[model samples]
Target: MNQESRRALIRKLVASRGECSVEQLAVELGVSGMTVRRDLQALCEDGRLIRTHGGATLGERATFEFAFLDRVNKNQEAKTAIARAAVRLASDARSVMLDGSTTTLAVARQLRGRSGLTVITTSLPAAAQLQHEPGIDVLLPGGYIRSASPDLTGSLAETNLELLRAEIAFLGADAVDDRGNVFTNPPDNSAVLLKMAASAQRVYVVADHTKLGKPALRRFGQLTQWAGLITDEACDPDFVDQLQQLGIGVIVAPFE
Candidate 1:
């Protein structure tokens, strides 16, 4: 295919799926990763799409949630570091609430064999990882499952959350603007997060640096809702200072 045709196809794919990674687009289009990235760069420059760490999304796709697998692959190293740092918060807590975000899933995988810990989660992925641990007790709330994600949400999940409380809740967001405003897609997802926050004595937002300074469709909550924000070292020092000014602690996970 010609360059024009490839670029056009790229636009179509991103539009239809809301997001597409450079490598995936190359495989689908029978092109090299370099070629696909070039096309994506051009499209982003033209305001046709928004460039993410390893992919591009529809220019106005803030309301669209990327596929779970896609997210799990992006910023892998950073997410791993953030997860390691966030898991330390659970050491002294008797109970913990983990949301279904991929970042939180990383933390869940590390919580195995912790004695006397009650794990409450809406994420099937996280629950699956901890349910069989000898020392950890996993709790799965009842709710409607979102086909796109393993998370259970809706009134049933919200009601289930009200009956339970946790020492700390680790949540995730699609974006966090410079003003410390947190955003996520779909009202249902936000509803569950809000309920989780209410049910926990402390809340921690876990996200990589890529999520900072971006704004998504819905403003689910603010930075103040959380006890602190845990992110990778790739985050800007200035941004960290701003968060500190707001009295929101910032934990920068070490990575090498």
Candidate 2:
């Protein structure tokens, strides 16, 4: 594709997907990663897009840091194991909050047949998945849906969250360290996570092993604040020990 064509395609992708990765663009446009990076740079120069670690986003919109959905799709087996463990943590007649991360969505998938529970969340996909369950009540919070992540945020979501409290909140983090630091990419999205974090009795971060060491721009909280860390078997025993040392419970999913 030509320069103008690549630019148009990038804008179209940003509008449709809310973010587009260099790899994705290259595949779509039949170009190299370097060419796509140059294309993204030009778009950034024109003030039409904002570039990130893996991709570029539409300018002027709130871009919640996210990886390509395909990346999430790549870890199905691990997520299934993690989800099974997360469901084990749930108790009876409880209120729970699930965030937008795919890991949290896995938890939502597992909670499907559970008898009586109120699941309050900002994830549209999670809400859709749970709304039809016979004995469970699914509640959605009001908010601006961030398209890339499909998560609710802003004052509207916060207002709904403020009115309710949860026994357990299954949270998702873009990044966590051995030190137990929670991080999000954009500061605005970080506020949404913080609000969700504060309204729960036990804050459980449900992450796959891939998220443990990668860093992001916005820092959310410290290690000790979390009730537990739930991850797949890929979690290194030594690293889990480090988090346990910080007084945060660690639940490693059973080996597949």
Candidate 3:
């Protein structure tokens, strides 16, 4: 494709998914990473998108429902770091709860093969990964699945959670505000998060630094509701201090 066509396609991809990485764009466009970066640069110059580390996203004014695969590819390194740290916190917990966010899915991946662990989750992806672990028991709360997210939601899911409690719950959020409020798009998604937190003895919100200091469509829980937070090193020091002030254990994982 020509320069104008490539640039246009890049913009379309970014706008549709909210974000697009240099590698993803390159592969999809059958071009080199350099070519993708150059197109992203042009898009940035035109004020069409914001260039992020290794990726480009629609500017602040651009809002779209975050697709699961889109999130899985964004800030992958940071998510892996946060997931590793979260797994350590659950090492001793006999029972755990996991949410459906892509970040929590990372944590679930790390929990595979954990012996004598009972995992209760609303995430279909998480359940699928842990179901085959010999020593791990995976339980799902059967309910209506959100086509876009593949997470179980609705009254059935909430009812199942009400009957059981977990030693710890690892959750994910779309954004977190300065006041420590966790936000997610669509009210039902936040509802499931709230139920999971309420059913756990302790809660840890696993999110990347990009989510910090931003609030999405709705607030599901306050920062005080969580016992700890697992985030990447890219998080702001001042924000970490704020969470610490609230008696929330702040664990910053290294991306490297």
- TM-score per model over all chains: 0.73, 0.72, 0.73
Which candidate number maximizes lDDT? 1
Give me the runs in candidate 2 sitting further than 4 Å from their true place.
1-68
Computed on alpha carbons, the lDDT of every model, listed in order, comes to: 0.86, 0.80, 0.85
Worst 10 residues of 3 by lDDT: 60-69
Tell me model 2's lDDT, rounded to 2 decimals: 0.80
Candidate 1 lDDT by residue in tens digits, 1-256: 9999999888878877988998899899999999998998888887778999899988743323334557777898998899888878778999999998999988888788688999999999899899789889999878998867778998999999999999999998888887788888764388889999999999999989999988989998888767888999999889889888988888999985
Ranking by lDDT: 1, 3, 2
Cand. 2 TM to true fold: 0.72
Pairs clashing in candidate 1? Answer: none
Q: CA RMSD for every model? A: 10.2, 8.7, 9.7
Residue 94 displacement (Å), model 2: 1.6
